[model samples]
Target: MPSPTAFQPVATAMPDNVRILSFEVGHGECTLVEFISERQVAFRCLLDAGRVLPAALLDHLKSNPRPESPDLDVVVLSHVDNDHQGGLPGLLEAGISFREYLSPCLPAFKRLRWLFGERVNRAVDRAFAFEQQLRSHKVAVQYPLEGFKSRYASSRVTLSIISPAARLIKTLASGSPERVSALVSNSPTPLQWLFEVDEPVNEDSQALAAVFDGRVTVCPEDFDTFLPGPPGPPASSLAQQHSQGDPDFFGNATLNDTSLIVVLDILLDGVHRKRLLFPGDQENWTYVAAQHPAGLGIDVMKAPHHGGRVYLRDKDEDLPGVYAWLRPKTVIVSANGQYDLPRASFRDVLRTVGGSLLCAHQRTFEALSAGAMKQPTATSCFQSMGCDRGRGRSVTVTLTADSESADLPACVQGSGITGLAPIVVLRQDVTVPSEGLLRYTYGELDRHATWIKDRLDEARREFLNKLKKTRTAFDAITEQPLTSWRVLAALAKADGRHDLVADPDPVLKFARSQHVFWCAPVTGYRASPESFASLPAAADFNAARRWLKSIPSLLLIVESGNRFPTGTARVEILQHADWGVFDHLLAGKLKHPAPVIADEVRPVLLPLIAADYSFRLCHFNYPDSHYDGGKAFLLLQRDSVVIPDLLSPEWQVAWDWHAHGSPFKAPWKILAKLASEQMLAGTYLQTPYGRDALFNRFKPSTTTPLPAAMHKARWVTY
Candidate 1:
């Protein structure tokens, strides 16, 4: 079998570099940092392992010499949150060795018992068990305290603990270790426990800054903890009533405020080049502003708490959102749509602040945005390596005396097809159609298949082109002019996955589409599949087929023969239709004057039109809760309204809806009301500009035709 390097693409190394990788661990987070010196890995550390340890690190460990070989220098558990620390046990089971394990101190866990009643018993026991296992493995366990410093691998690389302040530890240890454990009572109604107050434990999370080659990166793990109690009730009456139903009900509200904020300063020889901040899930920006009154001029920031709702402004102080105060040029978010995060409002805030957003999982945001915006890059490693073997985003920054650079690229080529949209299909278990419906699509399956085929072909050619020599057992058993199927069999045998030879396609397809959410392509990142059949034996072909059926069908039936884009009407059907269908429709012929339509019913109207002209599409939709949906007008103007002219500053468009409320409320009183609700759809325009939002404007009236020998013009849908 060919060596791993023979098949994997080799990336050129920089002399001194720091590579920060965040994995797509469902709704969790696992990030890895590598310190490279002289084109070789000098040190490695992990911030969090997420719910399930990333497959990339697992594969690397498996390829090592033995369990004794140290794969990592340190592993930091951000907090006790299941989504953060759930994967540590798996990492330990993998026989991976590390020098140190950093996390919240043990005393803090003990104190949490009394503070949260018996709700934290299971979590505390799990933490204790994990610590015991690490001790058994002879790995040193350390609690990150403020100002703690350590040096490893090379004296040039250093780690400085920044948070979980000494004062916080003192406060935690002040409480008694012994507290009454709740006892069950037998009665007609179940008993309940109530608390007058609650303390935030998330502040005990580990926060540290690492300096390599004189460059620093800070990781403030969940510093949402504040010493003083919040203004509102500690735990709501509703929470007390349903506390038994939700495991983390009490801690949910204030947990984000406990996030420890980290700052990374990239400087070479004391000259600052860049600053990056990782605030974890910190929601109270006022705390951050208090800490840095001068303001943090950050170049990039990982959106706090997966872009959840944050307290961005301090009304009394008259301060701006943290993004605006810090003025970060780029905002990176790590989330996979759990609890509907990185929220739409959060993304809009970033755009409004002029910070370009980069998501570890682009499809997650794409589905959330619902075509209101598009995530431009597939920055996650899962996109390049195929979710089967590779995981998360790998953002590498190289620092040298003369230059500093940052690059995020997906290994494989992105899909050329545009306007590929996601469709939601309600599940059988769903009760509320609007909120319960799940978005489904075939995410990058075609690209993954093609990538696999290319690798097989490359391997076969290299084997055939070798110089003539005595054939070994490997070469003699194999046939000449090797086919792709034969190559796959060889790979399966090498990997000890014999089942893969029988049915490889289904197994790969099912695994490759795991993390990505939407049907469209995410750009950026450069890498390839590191191994074949990296996962355990998958279910049979029929089982995989059943799983694939969960994705919504893209096929659409064109209505009205004359109304369709091709003008052939009923004969034109859209099979596997993407959002690109809109482009074809806009360019295609229309039989009648396009009516003012609602954006909510765009997908619903696809199956009709050819069915009936007067069929009201809005009947299938729910009532509008707010006047959030605006209108778009596809006005036709000759060469006068060109693309560039519209983009110029002189022609900049702005709409102030607040200045004139309710367009219909005073339609006769205000002349502007006739077109105030209408926005420019520009069906014929195709440019990168104005793609994020439609330009709202007044519709213009047409004049009488006076050109000699004028011909009838055709119309298209917006």
Candidate 2:
């Protein structure tokens, strides 16, 4: 991705402050400005720009104002780089003339020298052209700085210059040829001063002060602190030179040492704030100590020389004004490319004095490249304060595999999944998620099952959504003759997650519609029908209403109850041989008692067979086992086929997969058996409430197994 530029306009400036917009690599553009108030603004000094006046960004700045407002008081040029000055020429070309202004005088500019040639003065010639443009309107020329500001008391614009003291310039101008040449050579050229110089050889470079509420902000453009004083000099020589401390021969630093470093103090509406310090291409430390005795404390301090040790104390131990003076919460290193501020002296300044730092470096760029963070810009440092804890700890879905369960995706662990939990991925899943979305991989991390399963689930959901769009056909049954049994089965399949319905609204739409009359069954209805004796009544409005749709007088019946032969009253009884006629007679109290229960040859389900075809009860019978009492006789999905034993909490908890189909000739039982055999290869049995899945590799006796035609069947759940 393309990296955004460092400087951009936030909004139009007003009487008190101006707003600036900038973009960072991983983050988008951010706009901030100066606020004018009284209290020192203290440790939280931010660049305060004026009010955002009414105007379309690019248009307003360049066009002249109407006659009613006239023109502005001052046209302050903060700095000379393209980012800060991109619109200045157009504004100047327009009739929006300012009374007074401040800008650095350029000695030699590569572009103007290239365009207008060296012989003709660039600044003078440009000023002359501007003068001529004003004359066209019969206006008099007014030099903004020296004469105009001194004469006009009405003009509120004032620049308290903080750089290039005449005293230091005089000393440098009188320096030995070698020192003077070194200073000039070492000083940052107009091109080197700023990172994004669009047209090279910025001969018109004006490294002025950036203001926030009349306070200055330091824009340290490409200045390095690593330039040692007189390259080959030993420590003793420097120490000897430093002890003398004569202003004329400060010894060792360069001529660019005379370059002005500014800190702006802004006051407005009873709010006083010391904004930022903009260190121009000057690399001098001692000059400040000698010229100004106080330690310079500021709100935001742009790093000197890109965090180099050059800005050190006499002994290079105490970081001059850092700890005692600077109060920088944000130390920006605005470099175009990569560079690490070396560990030693710089860290001391940061730890002891400069405070926290932010930079546009390799790591910042890498995050942008990986799609994890945004690109480089001025705002990125402020935005990225703490490391983000992505997806931290509230996921709910889980996928279980035999000897493995990779349901939870790894990317999802720290994040919340309540927001429509992502369909876990699976190769065999319905569909794959779009690349645009964030994916997860959390199942068995060690074995990497999670990765596999999540992808499968995602794939499955993808396919199923498509599958629904294209309908599939099967053996046709009459749509009519619809029973409560069929409706329950369909509802169970649609809502039960075992079928994995990615979209629930449509399926649920159908289920809710079945409640057309939307009436409640008789307050938690429970119907009890008996075959030989009295049958229970249908209790609710829906059950009563259902009779209107039912075939009249359909005799729905329950199975006969089991009655064991009784013996004489005793705690323990003998076998059948010990039983006498009185025992049999007492059990039934009849001379000839007809049996209520069917014989053990076959398990009878009279309640199911005699439902008169309106409803069907699906159940399974497990042969009696020694594990507990008798094995549980389970009702897979029936309201009336419940076992009396289920009432006991113990049996309810023990019966895990003990449900539905019995070992009979029923089609459903056959399908269940087929599925059991196929899944048995590496199936797992999760108990009613199991933490772990136990492997069940049960294979059937028949090798042929079931055909695909039979395999297509859907296995209903309990």
Candidate 3:
């Protein structure tokens, strides 16, 4: 008991230095982090390739000395959106091989297919190509889920995924394609013309615009109208003006919401540590703030969404629950003059909160370091704060294990704080349990089983209810009266029985004559008299009979019901020895066409009408029928086919006709009815000619491409 042997903590070795380089890629983002040990770079990580790699960054990497295996330790794509990943292909093409590639879209090819369907094929194709290139280059690819953590650079640097939440990714993966598309296309509500006033003019607009990296000029009057009756103590004129703009004033929410947020913990020298936040382009700051509220104070934070005002609008106050939790010493904005980024109002808020602001741009870098060693004068607003713009638009801060304050570049040191106190570095050693490590108690297993059973029972009840409704609907339709020959003829045409109507036989002639006046008003009805007129006596009656035999059961029912009455005569005709050859055809089981009988056609017709089922008959014309029997009888089984919901009320009356005769008055009416129904259904009635007839019937109108000027204008507005 070596009161002697007092407990002694083990000492851990740490890297000598950590450096971050935020590249000045115009209107995009690319950051490089290097871990140094023994005054030599041990590991390198590239956050994004931006829209394009800056020449300076590329030149630096190309010229820098490298180890035998000169490879990037990590290359994170963040999300699949263009801006974040556009330069990656070029980087790879430039021969920058990486050890690991992390992105949310890498393992989501199936989800991408489901989300985009075929609409965004080009985007999906590029994503797939990127993945293939990575694999071909032997890069390890991973789709990091929330809470994923990894140690790199010999365990001196640790990175943890803060977002997106697992549930959000699952929702996107499992959601309907249409819903996902809608979400991707989500945009701010269009401003009403009534509320859209002319842009305002201000004396400081140009200066403010330049200060914001020349993104957008401030127009105070543009937002003045949106101000409340009286401003609260914390709500300044700037706050009201900023709040007047759209929530998505900086960028759309779709891609921004999927951003990969990470927290990096770097051991500077054993006991001293530094925390850096790289929140890709995450727009949902509230979620991040809520998830990591405490122990998240960091030395540096890359301002999210390119320092857009959406995250920090109120100059007099900090963002709700965010600023207090983070308390970042310095904020870096990686944006150039494009789409009005690095909002001036946000910079003002950052200054109000006593946090240093740095822009990843050449102009801002030069401005900050213009008089690095000089004292503040009346003309220099920024000089009061000892601002040190690190060399080459890159800021570097270092902390030593024994030092109480951070050692930063002379450009980054503000006048008030010559040195920064070491921030509390929170480390979470998350021991992810393996599959075998998961040991569920019996109670948990039982609870899971009960939940699954309840779900199955609910599904069963729903399915049974649906089945009951279907059966009831079927029964109700079956009890209706058998449709007359004329109505059946019309429905047969409507249900795609053009050949049945084309047949120039005696039974059809008899039915047509009986309903001559009855056929006039039927819409989509055409009496194909030309077919009969052109027919020669020797024309293929065998072919016609074969065609009749091949018709489907629903059509056969219509034909038979119209050709013969529901009586012993019909049964006798069907049971005739000559009709035996057509029995299989009537049962909808005919695989090949049988030889047609030239004289025993009546026997073939009997099988169609002998069945006891309700039918609706109408007189209509099949415009595209090869055989034009001027007016033909069409038959419809009440329950077999789905009627177009948008058909005219008159068509419904015609369908429900019980007058034992035709209910139509004109041939054009038939055409109109059929055209309207087909248009509404967006498909053609199935026929031997297939979808060609439907296409011919309802071809979309040709649209002329817009002029270049008009197209450009439309897209600008969009």
lDDT of 1 by residue, 481-553 (tens): 3233455567657766555555555535433454211111222561322233211112222232332223122
Query: Which prediction has more favorable lDDT, 1 or 3?
Result: 3
Best by TM-score: 3
Candidate scoring better on TM-score of 1 and 3: 3
Q: After superposition, how far is residue 203 of candidate 1 from its true place, in Å?
A: 24
Model 1: runs farther than 4 Å from truth? 1-14, 60-69, 117-121, 151-155, 175-247, 252-256, 259-276, 296-300, 312-320, 352-354, 363-718
TM-score of each: 0.41, 0.28, 0.42
Query: What is the TM-score of candidate 2?
Result: 0.28
- The C-alpha local distance difference test score for the whole of candidate 2 amounts to 0.28
Better of 1 and 2 by lDDT: 1
- Per-residue CA lDDT of model 3 for 141-170, tens digit only, reads 766756778888788889878777554453
Q: For model 2, what is the alpha-carbon lDDT of residue 631?
A: 17
